[model samples]
Each structure stands twice: as structure tokens, then as C-alpha cells.
Target: MSSFLTNSLKLLSGAIVAVALVTSAPALAAGGHGRKPVDPGFSFEGPFGTFDQGALQRGYKVYREVCSACHSMKLVSFRNLGQKGGPFYDPKYKNPNDNPVVKQIASEFETAEIDPDSGDEVMRKSTPSDRFPSPFKNDEAAKASNGGAIPPDLSVINKARNGHAPYIYSILIGYEPKPVGLEIPDTQHYNAYVAGSLATQWKGDPHHVPAGGVLAMPPPLTDGRVTFDDGTPSTLKQQAKDVTTFLEWAGDPHMVARKQTGFAVILFLILLGGVVYLAYRQTWKGHH
Candidate 1:
């Protein structure tokens, strides 16, 4: 009876150990799951990187040309493009000379007075110092412009939205003409991941539409809208990648630095853990 009771208690202890191991496995796995995949275009290896500089410049051009007509980048300044350590920005940046595009855009705006001591302008050519002014002076005007579709600010948009790179890229590339034969309900949209809640004011058929339902904005980039200067064939995918990367940089210019710092800290901790483990083993030698 004594031996039987002892065997039962041992079996119970083994079962408890097995249960503890099973429960702890998931928690250990959770720590290994790091950041989600960002949009590929933002990556150096992306197709956009073939002409990264030109892509960034062209993206800015696109913003100035078409996107600015609707959306406002209230956070970004023109000077930020000329700042140090940015993909587009060159600290030793030179002004575009005789560039018809730049000239045409610059012609519309007037420069303000420069401060003498600071040598900086009180107002410049919608520079980095200047916040991107909205096309509409007020909310009422903005509503009047786009059938009540208030164009969101582009600044920090990459950060605010989830699924980051891919989401933006998908939004840009996902534009398709309404398909026939498929009857989409008014409530359901063509989202890869549907939203839990939608606004009451949302009109238009959600089906046969982009992922973000009720986007009043039409397919801005159909094929051949913008040509790639690098002799690579211009495609919507390339455009999406370029624009997404440009936006990603704008969203978090310091991501690379931050990632590097984080990696360094992690390495230090790992080394410290190893050293402590070794010391512990040495101290416990011959104890058990």
C-alpha cells in the first residue's frame, strides 16, 4: 500500500510538470514574434529601390501634382526632404535649376521675408519649415470638394494605419474596375480584411470597391499615368512600392536607427545572460 501510494504521488508530480511545460511553451513562442512585415517597396531590395532616388522625387512630384489637390500632409515640411539622413533628403542638396516641373510649381507660390540674424526665411517656397497647407481653407470647403470624402492628412498616415507597408501598397495597387456577374451587397465591401464598424455617412456600393470601403477617391494610378525614368517598365506595382516606401520613410525617418539601437541592446542582454549562466554553473559545481 505504501509503495502504491508513493508511485501515485510520483505520477501526479510528473503530470503536473508536463502540464506546466505545455502551458509555458506558448508564452515562450510569443516573445519570438517580432514586428510584422512592412510593405516591400519600402525595403532596399524592393523593385522601387532600382530607382529609389528618382522614385522618392517622383513620389513627391506626384504628391505635389495630384495628391495635393485632395490630401494635405500637415506634418511634413519641404525642408524635411533636404535634411540629413533621409532617402530623398541630401544635406548638401542643390536646388533644381531650370526644371520645368519645379519652376511651374514654384511659380504659383510667393516667398516671405527672411529673418536677418537666423538667416532663415519667415516664409519660403512651401518649404520643409512650412506645414503642408490644405487646398481648402476650411472644413466646409473640403467637404464641398470631394462629395463629403474628407481627404485624410498624408503626414504620419503610414504610422497611424495598421499593416503599414503592405496596406498602403495594397490600397494603391488594389484599384480595379468594377467586375460584372458578381453581385455585391451594399453593406459588404471588397476588403481583404473587413472593418468591424463603418461610418453612417458611408455611401456607394462596398462590394466591387477597395478594401477600405466607401473610398470616394477613384483609381488614381491606372497604367501608364507615370513613367519610370530608369528604363524599367512603369507599372502600377512599381508605383505602389515607390510611393509606399516614400511614405514609410516620411512616417518614421528614424526607424533604421531605432532598430539598430534595439538590436544592440538585445545583443548586450544576451551576452550578459550567457555570462550570468556560466557564473551560476561555476558557483553550483559539485552541488548536485
Candidate 2:
């Protein structure tokens, strides 16, 4: 009897631990590589948190002025910016397509249209329905322009990376001076956030191999690179954070709504459990 009780207690403890780990999986999975990612304490981090509208808008500006030079967000349409929960969403515009701000933003870009009468392709101002155009015509062209490195699309980059927004934030501001005894090609720059494998590149002690990886791209952000209309200081960290926020929203636009639904479901489940427990107790009360 004593041994059985001990075993049962151990099993229960193990089950509890397993449940805890499972519940914390999302946070754990969002962690970074060798170097830890800095948490910017974003508004949309916790279960009940929502996207920060100002950050989203500023981030969009950063992408437009800086990142757009190389990277593309092809998955996002111009009208997405004016949709509910988006950066430029206005209550006045129920239809994102008809949103004047979105329309104006789209029209700034020239899109190719075929003239019906002349049967000739002509460059016309883009509409809200248009997707963000790629800077390069093709992958080969992008590679050629970028020294054989094709910039990854920003549309879903936050989702694609393991550390999510934090990892991207870390990378954007992660450039560091190269460590001694670590050799990399001239084309590659060192970023401390990466988990660099130095199996062939390390000339130092095997046990003390440096943490970080080589990047094909140099540091893309600088202080005051973008001036914010809201008067937010355009520091390197701020730009990184804002752009990361925008990328996060682009990657998972429905995150806040999904979290709300999950919270509702959890509340319902808890209430259901309570009701079921009460029913069970009532059914067995007299007999017990």
C-alpha cells in the first residue's frame, strides 16, 4: 500500500510538470538562438494584449522608406493597411477598398496596366487592391542586385523565424564586431544574435567557440533613419521595434481576435467543468 501511494504521487507530480511545460510551449518556442532575444514588452505579447496602432503605423513607414528598398511584402495588399485592426484603419471607412487613405497610399505607386484600345502595357497609378510590388523582377535579379543574397519577404517573416518578433528585432540591431579567431568571408557580416556554427571557421579553443552567425546583409538600420510623424524619436531600437511590430501584425493579423476567442473558450470550459462537477456531486450525494 505504501509503495502504491508513493508511485501514484510521483505519477501525479510528473503529470503536473508535463502539463505545465505543455502550457508554456508557446513562450518557449518563441525564444531565440544562442544569444537571448530582447523582449521589447510589445503591447500584443500577453494573452489579452492587442496590437499598438501607433507602432504599427510607424513600422509601416519604416518598411516603406527603408526595408522596401530591398525587401518586399508581396502577400499584403495596399488596402490591408486600412482594414479593421490595421495601422491606418478609420471607423469612417467600412470598406477597406474605398478607404481614401489607402487609395492615396496605393496611387503613389505606379502599377502596370494594359490599355484596352491600344493593346499596350502602360504604367498607371496603383489602386488599393494592388499587392506591394517587388523591388526585383525575379529571384535572379534580386540576387544579382544584392550580391547574390535575395532579401527574404517581410510579409510573414516574423512567423517564419522561431523567436518571432523578438528574434527579428534582435537581428536588426544585433550587428557586432567580429570576435577574434572566428573567420568569415568578406560578404558576410557578423550578428551576435545568430547561433553561428564555427566548426570549420573557428581557430580558437573548441570549448570556447563564439556565439553568433554570419549574415549576408549589413546593419540595415541607423539612428534617425526615419522621422516619425507622431514625434516618436527614430532611434535604432525604436525603428527595429516598430518594424518588428508591423511584421508581427503582417504575419498574424488575427492574433488578438484569436486570443479573445481562446479566452472565451477557456472561460466556457471552466464553467462547464464546474457544472459537471456539481452534477456529479449531486448524483452521488445521497448514496455517499
Worst 10 residues of 2 by lDDT: 26-35
RMSD vs true structure, all candidates: 8.4, 4.6
Candidate 2 residue lDDT tens string, 1-288? 999999999999999999998989877754433587777888889887899999999999999999999998989999899988898899999999999989999989987779999999998889999998889888999999999989999999998977788889999999988888888888888888875565578788988777768888888899999999999999999999999999999988888789989999999999999999999999999897
What's the TM-score of each model vs. the native? 0.62, 0.85
TM-score of 1: 0.62
Model 1 superposed RMSD (Cα): 8.4
Encode model 1's per-residue lDDT on 15-131: one tens digit a residue: 999999999977765432222333554554332232256667666655665677888776765555654435454434454323344344444554466789898868556433445
